[model samples]
Target: MFQQFRYFKPIITISLIMLISGLIISCGSTSSIPIPATPTKEVEVAVVPPPTPTTPAVPTSVPAILAPDDSCVNCHSDEVQLLLTSATEEVEVELSEGEG
Candidate 1:
């Protein structure tokens, strides 16, 4: 029994050491190799190009009337109103010489 115990002790110690080493190696980072302290160099800023003159700026004297919506309701306001109230609905207001 003593002889068996002596022979098995060294084998158990060696097996435990191998298991721990294998576990540590497997758990370590697969992507990177760890290197000691080194400072990185700074990059210089690049100069931007100035804007070139092309088209003239539009005058504010001109009354810029922007169209209302994305749809045709901007130009046809009367048609939109008529469509909203069914086909039979009548509008009594009389239009002036140039108006609809």
Candidate 2:
């Protein structure tokens, strides 16, 4: 009987050690409280209209310029008439008659 008690003493020692550690851990007090989450709400936006584009107007008519022979007559009509009368038959560079 004494032999059996001596053999079980180590098991009793280990059990007591486990029980003491459990008692020490449970002695602390702690409580968890949940926070209320805010909702993500979308805002309504107003639609803006686009601006109209302005058009540029262009003018139509253009003035005409005098030809080379007409400009020569405009500056010196008397010289042109005198040269026309004095020109020979072989002088093939002929002017338009009465054009000036």
Candidate 3:
């Protein structure tokens, strides 16, 4: 019984020391650590009114109508110009131009 008491007493003392240290360590950490502040429910939101719809200004001059004969030129002018520019870069061509 005396031998058992000697072994058990050391184990009990170590366990108690460990438990007390753990509690003390936890308390110290909790005090040092920053807890986030709760957010306020009353937020100041800017209530923006929708933009007032303004009428577009009337045209000062009449717009020109597309010529019926030159429908292809009117529609594909940009594409035609791009193709011509690329083609000219590759090969030199002499042009007898009546109109641009």
Candidate 4:
């Protein structure tokens, strides 16, 4: 039994040495070091003046030049006016016939 235990003595000695070294390394001092301050630079800034206010021009009359035939102005103005006039005439004719 003593002969069999002799072979494990070197292995146990190596394991104990590694464990002690690891403990000593982990338990060492952990002091904080001071950092140096950086120098500041001066910057130049330009001041701008505010813009002056002006009156906007207002139109007193419509322009003599007409818009193109395919423009939305023709569709909204001419087409809508024709439909309104025809609808009023039809309503007037129906009222006259009903009265007769």
lDDT of each: 0.72, 0.67, 0.74, 0.66
Q: What overall lDDT, based on C-alpha atoms, would model 1 receive against the true structure?
A: 0.72
Q: How do the predictions measure up, each by TM-score?
A: 0.29, 0.29, 0.32, 0.28
Residue pairs whose backbone atoms clash in candidate 3: none
Worst 10 residues of 2 by lDDT: 27-36
| lDDT, candidate 2, 1-100, per-residue tens | 9899999999999999999986776655333335457787888787544444654444544545644456655546688676777647575677679857
Cand. 2 Cα-lDDT: 0.67
- C-alpha lDDT (0 to 100) for residue 41 of candidate 4: 69
lDDT tens per residue, model 1, 15-36: 9999999888877956465666
Residue pairs in clash, model 1: none
Worst 10 residues of 4 by lDDT: 87-96
Model 4 CA deviation exceeding 4 Å by range: 29-100
The weakest ten consecutive residues by lDDT in model 3 span: 55-64
lDDT of 3 at 37: 89
lDDT-better candidate, 1 vs 3: 3
Clashes of each: 0, 0, 0, 0
Better of 1 and 2 by lDDT: 1
- For lDDT, the strongest prediction is 3
